[model samples]
Target: MRCARSLVRIQSLRALTAAAGGTVQPAATRKAPHARSLIAHEPCGQALRSLHTACVLLKNRPVATDYQEKSEREGEAAKSLVTYDDLFERAALEAKTKATFNQVLDVFIKRDIRRRGHVEFIYAALRKMPEFGVERDLEVYNKLLDVFPKEIFVPRNYIQRMFNHYPRQQECGVQVLEQMENYGIMPNVQTKVLLVQIFGEKSHPVRKYQRLLYWFPRFKHANPFPVPHQLPQDPVDLARFSLSRIANDLDARVTVYQLPYTDVCETGEEVTQPYVVGIQSPDQRHLLAKHNPSRPVFVEGPFPLWLRKTCVYYYVLRADPLPPEEKVEEPVDPERCFYYPLQLELDLERDLGDDDSFDVDEVDEGPVFAMCMAGRGDQATLAKWISGLQETNPILGRTATVFRLESGVRELQSAAEPEPEARPGEEEEELQSRGVKQ
Candidate 1:
C-alpha cells in the first residue's frame, strides 16, 4: 500500500508537467518531500508489459477516478425544470406557494391586472392553488388572516381553517389581525366589523352611534368614538392593503383634480383612498377616468360607480338616502299660491310676433346668485342648487326671485386636445383589421 501510494503521487507529478520528458527532475528546485517520497520503482524492462495491462483496464472498465468527456456530456439537463409561464400558472393556482408566488406575482400584476375581467382571472388563478402554503403552522395562520380578504377562494372558512390549525387562532381569534401590527395594517371601522363578526360578534352598521342611548350589547364596553354622518372629506389612503371586496360596503367616493394651487395640494405618504401623487399609488387614476361609464363630474340619484384598473373604487354618496323610485320634490300648485291666472294676449306684448328686432328695453332682471351643483346624479341635486341660492341681501328674499338660464361653457375644446377620431380612409381598414383575440 505504501509503495502504491508513492507510485500514485509520482505519476500525478509526472502528469502535472509531462512535457519535461522522462527525467525525474525536481520542480522549481524545491526541497524533496522528506515526509513522504516515492518508495520503489518497477524495473524499467517490465514497464512495457505493465502498460498493456493498464490500457486494457482503461478501455474495458471505466472508474470514477477516470475523467471521460462522454460522462460530462451525458449527465447535464436537456432543459431547465421550470419556466416563466409554469411559475405564473402555479402562482395563479397555489396558495401554499405564496412565498414563492411573491417571487413572480409582480409580473402577472403588471401584465394582466387590469379591468374587472382581468382581476377576476387573476383571482381565479390564485384561488386554484392550495389554500395552505409552505410556512410554520402559526405563520400560515397569520398569513391567511392578515394578507387575504374574507374567504375569497373557499366559502367563508379561512378563519375556521386558522382555528383548526392553531386553536390559539380560536382563543385569540386572529392570527392575521395580530400580525397586522408588525406590518402596520391598522384596522379600519369596516375591518373591525369583519373582525368582530369573525370572533362571533354581530353585524350591524350604526347610523347615529352617539345618539344611541344604550351601548351596543354585542360589543365589549369601551369608550365609544363618534361616528360621522358622512366619512371625512379627506380620509387616510390605504391603497396598499385595501380590498375591492368591500367596495360596495360604504358610500365612499374620491374625486381627483389637477389644481394649480400648491397650498391645497396634498403631498405626503398616506395609506388611504385614491392617490394624489406623492400620496398613494398611481395605478387607480387611469381606471377611474377611462372605464367608468357614469357622469365624469359630481352631480345628483345614481352618480358614477368608478372602478379603475388599479382596483381603486370611487363612487358617489347621495346625501338623501331615499329609495330611487320616489319623486325628489313635490311642486306647489300655482292656483293655490294666489289665483295666478294667465295674462291676456293684449297685455302680454306691445308688438305681436315679438316685433322685427328685440333689444334690452330696461328689463328688470334680478341680481344673479351663485349656486353649486354637486353629485349631480338625480333631480334632487338640481333642486338643491336652485333652492340653495340665498339672497345676496336678506331683505330681497322671494320677492325679487327671477329665473335665468346660466349655462357654463358647455362647448369648446382646445386645439391641442387629441380626439379619438378616425382618419380619412382608415375607418373601413380599422374594422376589417379587428383581428380575432386570444
Candidate 2:
C-alpha cells in the first residue's frame, strides 16, 4: 500500500511537471522512499492534489452537502428572525428622540447604497415615531419617504401600473401616509414631491397625498374649539384654560383663589401650596342664589378634563335633580331681540327655518353652580373654594354642603348617594368623599 501511495504521488508530480513543460524523471526509476521524499519537497503539486482529492470527496459525500445546505438555511432563518424594532433600538442608543430617530434613518441610508430592507425600516420608523416624538413632524416623514430608491418603484409600463407594480413597497408607502393621516398631519408639497419621486404620478401613495391635500384644508378649521399644541406649563394657567373651555359661557369669570408657592418653615421643612382656580358665570351665580339652603350642594371632582395630551382635575359645585313640583318655567320676553325671534307660533314642517330646536326631551341633570380646578383635591383645598363662592352667591354660607370625591383618576361619583368611602389602608392620591354637614 505504501509503495502504491508513493507511486501515485510520484505520478502526480511528473504529470504536473510535464504540464508545466519542465523535464520530469520517471517514477519507475525512483525508489518508493525517494518518491515519497520528492512529493513532500514539492509543496505546490502536493497542495493541488490534496485540493483535488478534497473536492472529489466533498462531491461524493452526502453529509458535507447536507451540512452546507443546513448552515445556509439556518443563517437565513436567523436573519429572518431579527425584527425591525431591534434596528431602532440598536441605532438610537442614547435617547429615543427626533434627533436619534433621524440618526437611525441616516445610518440605514448610508449603510447600503441600495437601502435594503427599507420597507421594514419604514414600518419600524412609523411604529417608533410616537416614542421618538416626531410622528406629527412633516420633515421627518419626508426623510422617511426619501429612504425608498427613486424611480425603481415606479411602474415602467401601463401593464405594470394596472397590476399594482411593487405591491409590498406601495402598501408600505400607503401605510406611511395612513399613519400621517391618523395623526391628523396634513401632507405638504414636499411630501407630494417625495411620494411622486418614490411612487409615480399614478400610485396609491400619491392618490392618498392628493386626497389629503384636497380634504385637509377643508377640515383643517372644522373644529371650532381647537386645543393648542402646547398646553400651559403653569398649573394655574392650565386650570384656567381648562375651566374656561368647559364653562362655555362668555360671561364666565375665572378666579384664582391661591397661587402655587413653596415656603420654608422655621423647622427648615418646605411646604408646597397647590393652586386653586374657579369659574362661574352670572347665570350660574343666579342659580346658586336660588338653590334651597335646606338641600345640600355637592363639591364633586377630581373629574378629569383632557386638554390635548395633558389631563387636569376639575371640581363642580352642583346640586341634585330639582323635583318636578319645585321646577319653575321662566317666560321669555318677546321683544328681547329683533334679529333673532325668541319662539315661533306657526309650527309647520320643520325645515331649515328659524326653528333650530330638536324635538327630543331636555335632559335635566342638575344646575352646575360653579366649576373649579385645584392643584390638590383634598377636602381642605376644596373647602376654600366653597368659601370663595359665598362672597359672590352668599347662598353657600347658609346651604348644606357635601363632598363627593373619588380616589381613582377621572372617576365621577354620584352626589345622590354619598355613603361609599374610599377603602381604608390604601395609599392613593384622593381620600373618599364623605357626607359631612357644613
- After TM-score superposition, the amount by which residue 167's alpha carbon in candidate 1 deviates from its true location, in angstroms, is 31
Q: Write the per-residue lDDT of candidate 2 for residues 17-66, one digit (tens) a residue.
A: 45754232233223334554555565443332223333433444676777
**Number of clashing residue pairs, candidate 2:** 0
Best by TM-score: 2
Q: Estimate each model's TM-score.
A: 0.20, 0.74
Task: Report the CA-based lDDT of candidate 1 relative to the real structure.
Answer: 0.33
lDDT of 1 by residue, 215-269 (tens): 3433423524322222324322322123222232232332222111324326664
lDDT of each: 0.33, 0.80
N/CA/C clash count, model 1:
26
lDDT of 2 at 103: 88
Q: Which of the numbered candidates is closest to the native, going by highest lDDT? A: 2
* Per-candidate alpha-carbon RMSD to the true structure: 26.2, 11.0
Model 2: lDDT of residue 285:
86
